[model samples]
Target: MKVSAKLFIVGSNSSSSTRNAVDMACSVLGVAQLDSVIIASPPIEDGVNLSLEHLQPYWEELENLVQSKKIVAIGTSDLDKTQLEQLYQWAQVKPNSNQVNLASCCVMPPDLTAFAKQFDIQLLTHNDPKELLSEASFQEALQESIPDIQAHEWVPLWLLRYSVIVKSRGIIKSKGYILQAKRRGS
Candidate 1:
């Protein structure tokens, strides 16, 4: 089975979290390596926009995994032409592909298309929401799922989605989501 995983970093998280998530996925999937791991990191809400600086740490971690043969390829989600160019130039391991949200822009920007073509990076389309899960929605679900838990105090750190595909037939065999959360204070 060919396994692919996408890690969604919802907020400010340590670079090491990427390593931890990959390790967990490998352990669970019982595979020493994954076919690909795509990162979907939301911009930090400090009023500043998403920049290469915000992505460097995460990319570095993924690059390390690639070097160690734990992950074959790495990609990004929701990055524009400018952001993608910055990362591609600065990164030691260039991104193999990028996912553009069709909902945001009905047509893929020509600049992005040209850049991807020039760099030989694959351009993929997706309709995923800007935010997969809002904090309030997450808390509500948690509270309902586990009646006694203090849902409000817990903050979701990251979510990993993995899928197993039948390579020969090009069919998905199984898939699941893994969410990691932490308490507000320690």
Candidate 2:
């Protein structure tokens, strides 16, 4: 099967630097054509940070955009079950599995991990090693110990919201045909 590359940017802050990083990465990685970009509101803070409640206001607009377009990237630091459920309900899409993608530096709580598994989501971890290993035996052992990976079955709707925000802000470009096709499919 052909796998369309869909990038999910979780825990993204709304700072200029954060936005720029995502934009730059999307451009360099050529992620604009693959799927949607989702941006969750930053968490609330004492005049210091963006909070989830702060993001709630934009939820409707974000949802509209996702429904209109078909991208699937989202930015949010809050990944708790309650929030996840709310997002799923808002997007009107049921998550097939609780699987989540783990990129380098993204830390997840053990309880959350267990919760995700209970929901039937597999945790996929990807690490980019920059250094060459000197021990071939150790490398072989590591390779033998790693298990095979599989894709999750469900796509969350809140992810759709995040994807729309990313597209609206021009962090990523939307694919016209794919968006149209997705809308029709829905």
Best model number under lDDT: 1
* Residue range 1-186, candidate 2, lDDT tens digits: 111222222222233323333344345444553243333233343466433355554444434434544334333333466665555555543333333335433777677676666755444443423211223333354446653421121111211111223534555433321100011123
Poorest stretch of ten by lDDT in candidate 1: 40-49
Where does model 2 exceed 4 Å of error?
1-34, 47-52, 70-75, 89-107, 118-186
Give the whole-model CA lDDT for all candidates, comma-separated. 0.89, 0.37
Cα RMSD for candidates in order: 1.3, 16.7
lDDT of 1 by residue, 1-186 (tens): 899998988756798888888999999889999899999865587677998988999999999999999999999998999999999999999999999888888888999999999999999987778788777888999999999999999888888899999999999998998888889988
Clash list (residue pairs), candidate 1: none
Per-residue error at 112 for model 2, in Å? 1.4
